[model samples]
Target: MVDVEIIEMYIPNSPSTLIYIPGITSSLTQPELYSTLHQTFSKFGLLYQVSVKNVDSEYYTYIRYYSARAASRARAAALRGEIAIKDSGPVRVTGLSRSGFPNVPLSRYKCEELANFYLGFSGWRSKVLYHRKEESDPLMVKYVSVVSLEFPRDSVSCEGAGLCEQPLASAEEEGDSYIDIITKTAKRSLGEAFLAAWGKVLLIVVEGSKVQVQINTTKEDQFLYNPVWDEPVVSVSEVEYTQDAENEDEV
Candidate 1:
């Protein structure tokens, strides 16, 4: 069946709030990938609003936020509000190497929009993060620790290898790359420039030059996101992440 888990879920104030998606490789095989695995769904039923239900066996959709394919599918999910995770979509991966790991220790009681950039990414990243120090719940600290423990640190795959590299594309597309398309949105605020506010939205993969944003629009509303004014790329740099071997026990 489609193994959908909410290991450390804390429904934010709005749909636009950042929701963490850990390793898909693990999400597929791990039962705890869902909220029930974390043992907090029924208790905190007030929080989540069932995004995706019975996903079936092989997972129907699996993709990043920067990919065009991912954007289209995720948008469809937000429409139904009950999408199946892991079929296939655009490739919009946010974090590279170990920085991408859902590396939080405590689930915060309240949803806090944390860090805006991923570690060691360069020139407009394909993703953004809620980088937090604690897990959303205190009681679940142990579970979060388990995740931290299980996160692979020095894998060759993280250093740009394996099935991971197939989804990425050029930075020259539409004057954007998988990285630029995402980092731009995560970092820039359209409202700051007297533009319309972006409501509930989901990001697909960052492929070629275009990164898709699946707006959480209603049936009557259009999924088009047009900015009257877009600020040019001023400075895009890489986020360098170096794992201190001495900090091995830090997680």
Candidate 2:
């Protein structure tokens, strides 16, 4: 039997999930600072997003966690002077609450990163199951691709398909551009499909414990369907079994 859980799309826009840290003492322009911040806060829980910005000549950072419990725990730790970055003094953490904040969808790169971070590289795999040219014309070509995502430990697999239309250029010098577009379209389709499937699988970590809650997508995220100017239709859900399962399950 397959353990199927519906990934709910509606994440309550509560302030408890958002954490604000001010006066980091590091230059906000440094790219390494963001990585260090991510590595630090992600330890408390699965982070929704982390960003640092300059405000009034001070470096301020915001850490958003998927789980409010995780946010609370991180705040408690910060209050105790346990959290610091690169010899910076103890950071101050606070919650940012607003009247009606929207739940922005995760990007394809972010989805891949989170999946790898929590599930590990070997925990999940995506394979191209099918591909075909659907239509062609003098100036354009259409192709369709089907991809399968497998999480072996959970005995779960999801299938999704993507459709794309690529424009053809008349100039021979631009042939590489056409091929590159087609290749990118196919990859985007694959990523979009994976986004829809993975979006349903929410990873929530509190303290040291982690949980995966499958939420029913109440509405199709507009972000998942269209990556670029021309939108690709994505279809999902079919299962395949893997023969061998690896034993490196540590989140």
Query: Candidate 2, residues 50-137: lDDT per residue as tens digits?
Result: 8888766677887877566677889999999898777576788866768266765577566666667666888778776655565577
True-structure RMSD for candidate 2 = 14.5
RMSD of 1: 25.6
Model 2 lDDT-worst window of ten = 3-12
Q: Candidate 2: where is the Cα deviation over 4 Å?
A: 1-14, 24-36, 85-88, 99-101, 169-176, 203-251
Alpha-carbon local distance difference test for all models:
0.26, 0.65
TM-score of model number 2: 0.65
Q: Estimate, for each residue in 193-250, the C-alpha lDDT of model 1 and write its tens digit.
A: 1111122223232332232333333312112322221344555577766677888755
TM, every model? 0.15, 0.65
Off by over 4 Å in 1: 3-197, 203-213, 219-251
Error of 1 at 106 (Å): 21
